[model samples]
Target: MNTIYRLLLVTLFFVSQNNQAQKRIALFNQKDLKGWYAFGEEKGKTNNADELFSVENNMIRMFGPKAGYLMSEQSFRNFELTVEYRWNTDVNVVRKNNNKNSGVMYLVPAETPDILWPKGIQFQIKEGATGDFVFLQETTLNINGTKTTPGKSVVSKRFADAEKPIGEWNQLVIISKNGVITQKLNGKTVNQGTESSVTEGRILLQYEGFPIDFRKVNIKKSK
Candidate 1:
């Protein structure tokens, strides 16, 4: 190949990569929880604890007992999300097992009492299992056009290095695109999977009987 031709080809490749990386698809507003909706009621009335969902000293506090979920009003299909979370109160009962702790469920269909619409997946958020991926509502997803169950687990073994001490901030990043999902905690890739189908769904924060805080919730488009 000629020198000029090779140089031109390399430049074109670089430009294409840059454009793909620069695409900003999803983002969470840091000022307030204007784009989020809270679920559940206390004492037969909807709980409007603004302090529970508001920013205090630059941190997002999520506190409430029972089964309430703070969900994003907007739905999404494929994007990369970044959130930093920490627990306000350290209680061992909440993080005892996989089922009783707080988690970030994304790509979830509108939820109902009888029929839960995870039709998506979840990024596990707990003390020891911060970056685990669990199937929630996705019946199926596609990886390179191959159909498969969405809730399948790619990393059944726990990666124990990502968790931070209670009351300290831990970083979480989730990348979902074309049925492929990846979760990172504290700069390490902990979980990844591919689904059989894709659907638009909202993000839900779980209420696992303890108080947890989220400092940052941000998302962006992926290439």
Candidate 2:
């Protein structure tokens, strides 16, 4: 009888622990753009109307005219986000002479200004700067031990440069919890900030100029 009781208790403990584990959701379905919407210079326009954003060969390709972003329909907080991306080497006319620029923006509030970029914490994705942090609009972050002033934009430099070659894929991992944010590039921790003014909001994949491909955008929520 005691042996049976011990076995039941063990089973119950395992079940409880499993229930408390983090829940992961794949933001990209790898086949369609069902849970995402596009916003750009042409406000109120349809997503990928000009082929700026599309899913082909199991990857999300951003190639077309105008600069904008692809945003998630849902808001999130206290989660870890992982995405893999690579440059396409096809420059648009608008940014023909400039370096490739793009970013992954998160913690975007619902009331963000309806401009090319709203308020959020951006994981900088650009040539030679893949893991930097850009605080857009009025967002602020406490880097190291200094508290940044609000209502102004700031760029927090990454601790290191971890981008792969132009055409090679690189993985970006961002973890946000309790007002603290950490950014990793290619399996290395490159940047981190504390005391974020914005803690929860939507996610944005930027469309700066050159074409970029993204895959495996997944997020795991903390319990």
Candidate 3:
């Protein structure tokens, strides 16, 4: 190849690789709630009250005496996110007659008002259903080639129950690109969808009347 043509080809190759490369970010610094905010369903933003959430020993502990969520202050798009979580038995959910329920909500538009459940797509982390895609607040996600309309959600048919036994950490990874998204548990891709209505927004870690522990909140995105 000619010298000039060789240089042009090398430049194009580097540019393509850079666009495909992902930039890593540590969402949770593990020392304190630096880049996050806490919102309560009843009172709106509490900035993570003492009784609602706490950070210690490189872990975030959520005490769900009520309904609220620890939300990321910044928005993201076309990224892969990973978080480790486990149900905290410190709070007896059965004694309170509540199912062990919590979730990771993403694509929450900044303009949307924060309520009991904000507008986003939720990776449902229930006892039986771990990888279900819940379109919250009329948010739509097309799964299995079918598009969801307002007030709809898609239960992952192939969503394997990869939830580790209670008290054991479960790794959850979510990838959102363009309009497509995938939900994974452990190392398995449990659910995926395309054509999300909300393309970019902030993320939320829910405290839905249940105690949960989280660690290693991180994300990688294309530049």
Candidate 4:
């Protein structure tokens, strides 16, 4: 190849790499819910408006008896997600469960039903230490390539460090890539597992009968 041709090719390659590296992805915009859709109770209330998701005091908060769901517009394959959230005190005069309850669910497939979502694996958000890691729906396999023994579930093997205090803004991080899932709470590794059922799926935030606050929920491509 000629010297000039080689130089031009090298410059083009450099430009391409730089553009990919500099890409700025927006998971959520402050002004309105640009990349999110409301499911469950809040769905019909929006009236097909552009900004369905609401923000108060710079935090996403939920209330009411009926459950709601907020999902990401774009599905993710392999990425690192960081979210911070706190639970708000319940206002129900009937005095049911006053404690906080909510969840950050990941690896959800595209064909999820409108009401039933617990079918997917749930990173629980409950009152006490139990909220840390309670595996639901999905099964966890053992190292021997067999499903885990009778009593134990996948959450036990992956996220023993799931303990977090109530009403506090806890940080949750999920790294999913190539069928491997790892989750952390408050900087502690809580769960790890491998599953081929899904490689990429939409993200969902639970609004199950309690008030919860979400500060930051963002994702970036892993290196």
Top model by TM-score, which number?
2
TM-score for predicted model 4 compared with the true structure = 0.74
Candidate 4 lDDT score relative to the true structure: 0.63
lDDT of each: 0.62, 0.84, 0.83, 0.63
Which pairs clash in the backbone of model 2? none
Measured against the true structure, the TM-scores of the candidates, in listed sequence, are 0.69, 0.87, 0.86, 0.74
Specify the highest-lDDT model's number: 2
Q: Write the per-residue lDDT of candidate 3 for residues 1-223, one digit (tens) a residue.
A: 6999999999999987886566578999999988898887666887654445789789998874567888899999888999999988874532222678889999999988878688898999888888888887788878788887688454445456688898899999999999899899999999998999999999899887767889999999864
lDDT of 3 at 42: 63
**Pairing residues by index, what is the TM-score of model 3?**
0.86
Worst 10 residues of 1 by lDDT: 111-120
Candidate achieving higher TM-score, 2 or 4: 2
Candidate numbers, best TM-score first, in rank order: 2, 3, 4, 1
Residues 1-223 of candidate 1 have per-residue lDDT tens digits of 6999999999999999888765654334556666666665443222343534555676556554445556777776777888888776645433323343678878777653312223456677765666665665435543335555445343233354578787778888888887677778888887665653445567776656567777567767554
Where model 2 places Cα greater than 4 Å from the true spot, the runs are 1-21, 43-52, 90-98
